[model samples]
Target: MAKSVNQATQAKAKADAVGQARALAPEVPARIGSTPATKFRGNPEIFGRLVEDHDKHRALLAMIEATAPNDPARKALFEEFVRDVHGHAAAEEQALWSTVMRNPETTEFARHAVGDHHKLDKLMADAAARDITSPGWLTHFATLKDEYLEHILEEETEQFLEAEKVLSEADQRYMRKVFERRKKAEKAAAVIEKKIALKPVA
Candidate 1:
């Protein structure tokens, strides 16, 4: 009876996690706005969506630490994470950073975010160098993870919010497309990784 109850609990937990993943997964038509143009005052809907992605990254990072070294699931999760994170950063760099840099009003915020990205890049490089199963892997992930959260908060509050005032309608549309395209690329990479993971090794 105890074993049966434990099995049921585990099953339910797995189901819940799957539901959450689906909820967080990136989808097409990734415009940052759903509200009417007039109502869209600051940060836009896309910024909120990006913040949600951060939450997903946090969950994925935790899962990576929990899984054993050489575990296919862990490898798969890590691959997805790296791809998605790279895409997210690339999208922002392409669309938003330049605007912030060009406009003197938000130059300080842009500089701060760029510095944050530099630190995150270092953290990512450090994490990639070590074995996923190593004792210090979680510690490494924690440091990167904390900086990432801080970066997200600062971007949303300072840069993106200010962007709503400075960027024209055309700029917003262009950026939305850039972010959407990169998200699709991230998903494609995940699919390729999954196929490779399934192949039998000699």
Candidate 2:
């Protein structure tokens, strides 16, 4: 009974934190007319694709936070979140950061973004190691949420602006295609990895 009560308290605290963060976060404007085949210069559509994923992740994180510990909904949502985020980060690193890193002006930003990805990966691993019903799992997940939100904000506001200045329209268009392809591949790999991790130990 005590354990259940404690779990409920932690869940409430986490939900409250997420709520506050959402309330304070500035609205991110959608990139206008960023379609795949758009003929506009600078291929602003790549930012649109990235921002779409960011919005999805933000929603998933919020939904996951709202669920109670050990809730099946939480587990399902978390797994989906993990697959999407891991795939998105890997694809972004290969498609966007790789190009950005070639420009001296954007190189440091690329490095910093990649570093944040690693940190988030570690946080996810730590949380996955803990049973969902435990306080420790929620604690790790909370940290992950905070860090991810900050990272995306920086990428959208600072890194993307810097990258646009450095990349040509051709580069942007090419990366948009590459990001789509790589994201699909990476998400498949993530699913396979998750299955392996969950396999019963022999």
Per-model lDDT = 0.56, 0.67
Tens digits of per-residue lDDT for model 1, 1-202: 0012243443343344334443433221112212111112222345534544554565666566556665656656666676777777766666677677888888887777777765666666666666667766677667666677667666655566676677765667667777778667744653212111122121
How displaced is residue 153 in candidate 1, in Å? 1.9
Candidate 2 has what TM-score? Answer: 0.72
Tens-place lDDT per residue, model 2, 64-105, is 676677677677767777888889999999999998898888
The parts of candidate 1 lying over 4 Å away from their true place are 1-45, 68-70, 182-202
Candidate 2 clashes between residue pairs 3 or more apart in a chain or in different chains: none
| Residue 179 of model 1, lDDT score | 72
Instruction: Provide TM-scores for the models.
Output: 0.64, 0.72
**lDDT over C-alpha atoms for residue 130 of model 1:** 62
